[model samples]
Target: MNATLVAVVLSLFSAVAYAAAAVAQERLASRTSDSGVVRLLGSGAWWWSVTLNGSAALLHVAALKYGPLTLVQPLGALTLVAAVPLGARVAGRRVSAVEWRGTALTLAGLAALLVTASGPAPDDVLSVPEALAVAGITAAVIGALSRPGTRPGLRHATASGLASGVASALTQTVTVAATDRSGPLLSAQVIGVALLVAAFAAGGLLLAQTAYRGGLGAPLAVVTLANPVAAAIIGLALLGEGLRGGAAGLLLALAGATVAARGVVTLSRPVPEPAQLPTKEPEEHPIAAELSEEEHPVAAVLALNPQSASYEPVLIPRQPAPAHLTPL
Candidate 1:
């Protein structure tokens, strides 16, 4: 098949794999309350996420091999459109109607973006130090942003999204470095390329986990959307990929950004109070649980925190609250 066709298929498949991995990660994040840094590396789900992302990265390289940079780079964006609904479905997280509208807008913007650009750009390569510098800076930001203890906020979300994007960009960069046409695949320096890829991927994963910890959707959208977008910008700047068209392209760019941004903004809105529910996990200590069982067994699941310090009450003979609580 032609390179564009290959790229199209690869992009779609990448979208699927990425979407599924994200669903798994979001679910894992929700279930645990550990530091995002620890969970970033410790979770088995993260490994799966990295693997899926690697596959996507490999496919992306193959696409660039035969296709135009314009075609291949924009197609990478399909992953953003793919991640959310898949996440919600897997996690039983429902999307609001506003979110649905936002998703549609993002997809529309991407579709427009892909169609507007034309022709492939020539291959380019970054020196070892250049790649390392880029990846290193990205890693620091991602690591800082994904701290689990941090409250979810615009800063964290934006940073996490940027880190995620950097991860995506570095993956593309590695793809380029690994498969540059004039050089041998492992010409005594491929190790550097491989290491960079791993480093960037790990950082991205950490950032994403943290992003989820702070907030969902918005951070998710930014990272997924921005990563490849940044890479494409780099490609245009460093590798000489043309912006394709003049005033029209500029207008399209603004409009598209607005649409995608709205979609992200809409998707990020928290669910309304009408759908709120209470949890008793914090209140489920041993005595409370024991008394709860005798009283309301139905509320146990609702009130129990899996890691709560309290234990289910056990009947012991006569233990009194020392003299302090007696009749003083």
Candidate 2:
């Protein structure tokens, strides 16, 4: 297979893996009472989710090795596409029309962005000091986001998505550096990048689980939107990548991104009320009414004899036969 084709396949597989992991994490979140890290660590479902995520990261790295960030990163949006149906299946709910529309819009926007993206540039290796600085800044941001009072909603999920994006960008950088080098993989640069990858990946997983607690749409959307943008920014700034059509291409990409973001927001909106079913008035049964009246006749008897302590036989005196009967 062509290297580009291989990368595309791997990227798609990675997206599916990510989608499965998101579904698993959401399931685990819904069932667990304790949201603590320790509790999550102990959960089997959580472990399964972790395993899926690990596979996804590995596949993504493989894809990055052969493909440009512009191609591979935008394709990752398919995770959101895959997740909607999977999540709906797991929850036993049908995907609403609005959700379907949102999904279409999101897909369309991503397609537009992908088409307008620039081709890959030559890889640039980061120096040890630059790598360390990046790692430090990423760690600090993640730490601040993980602090208490962040609340478990859009804010928290967005933070998590941002962390995940940083992880992805770093992963690409590290993969390129490690693969391009002819020497041993344990070089200082490679090792530093590896450690940052581990730290960021782990942090992203935890935050993603946290985000799942706030439902799949918003956090997933935020992550979906942030990840590629972050990768593209890093690629453009650090690497020598450039858009195809210069200013026009950049504007088109931006517009597409905006549309995609709007779709995500729409997808994340609260579910609309289900279609109302017509209600039928209960049919009255005459026999049932009679049975009810027979079952509670004490009230009627009490009304007739209010003075009586309880229901008993009441006798009336009978008069003697009429007088004036002739003797036989």
Candidate 3:
């Protein structure tokens, strides 16, 4: 098969894996009250989710190896579209109609933005100073956004999604750098990039997992929108890429983004009372209650000894029985 075909296949598979992982992680978060990573790590389901995500990352790398960033990265957004139905089925929960509409809008907007964007350009190896600056700035932003006081809803999820997007962009950069270079594997530049990649990737995973603590729709939308956008920015700024249709393309991209954002906001709005399933009432068991009453010997004993004090057997004389025995 041609490289493009391979890349397309890998990207599709990667998106599926990512979607499954997202569902698994969301289910884990919803069920677990403990927010600590250590506790989460102990769960089998969490580990399974991690495995799925790791597989997705590997497949994504393979796709990038064979395809352009512009094509492969945007396709990753399909994870959000795929996750909604997968989560609803696996978790046995119904996604609200509003959420479905929002998801559709987000997906459509993301596709427009990616399609209008320019093709990938040749990128030079980033200097040590440039790498350090980017890493420091990104770390600072993520740290600030992840502070304890931040509420655990759209705000937290948006911050996490942005961080994840940055991490993804960095991963692509590092992958390119590693592939293009023909030096010793343990070189200083390569090592530094590897460390940066690890740090960013770890941070992204933590943030994404935290985002799942909130509902799936808004946070997923943010991540879906932000990831390719961040990558596109990196491609334009550092990699020297330009838009296809210039001004018109920019306008179209902006409009698409606005539509997507509106959709997300609509989805994140409070669900109507009618959408929520009512709490089931406990069933009455008249037969069981009657059977229980009949089976207990304590009640019969209490009835037979109403006059007996301290629940002890009384020693009554048998004078009439003795007279009957003398006649026999």
lDDT of 1 by residue, 1-328 (tens): 6555666777788777766666666666677766446556777877887687677666666666655455565555456567667766765667667667877987777666665554553456556676677667665665576455667544554565555455445445556656776777675455775666666555556556655665566666666556666666656665566545677876775676567667666666665545457765665456444554335333333333457765544433234457877784
- Point out where model 1 deviates above 4 Å: 36-50, 66-77, 91-96, 136-160, 167-170, 273-328
Model 3: per-residue lDDT, tens digit, 1-328? Answer: 7665676688789989988987887888888756688998789988998899889988987776666565566677678767767866875668779768877886787667656653543345456676677778777877787888776655556566566555555666566667775656556776786688777766666677778788676676677666666666665676555666789988887887687667656655545545566799985344334444334223222224565544643222223335657665
lDDT of 2 at 259: 80
What candidate 2 gets wrong by more than 4 Å, as runs, is: 1-3, 276-328
Ranking by TM-score: 2, 3, 1
lDDT of 3 at 107: 73
> What is the TM-score (0 to 1) of candidate 2?
0.81
**Scored by Cα lDDT, where does model 2 land?**
0.75
Q: lDDT per model, in order?
A: 0.61, 0.75, 0.68
Q: Indicate the residue-level lDDT of 159 in model 3.
A: 61
lDDT tens string, model 2, 116-228?
Answer: 76354337765677667766776676667667877776656666666676677777777877777576666777887778778778877888788778788778887787778
Query: Of the pair 1 and 3, which is ahead by lDDT?
Result: 3
In candidate 2 the C-alpha lDDT for residue 82 amounts to 84
Cα miss at 241, model 1 (Å)? 1.5
* C-alpha-based local distance difference test score of model 1: 0.61
Maximum-TM-score candidate: 2
Clashes of each: 12, 0, 0
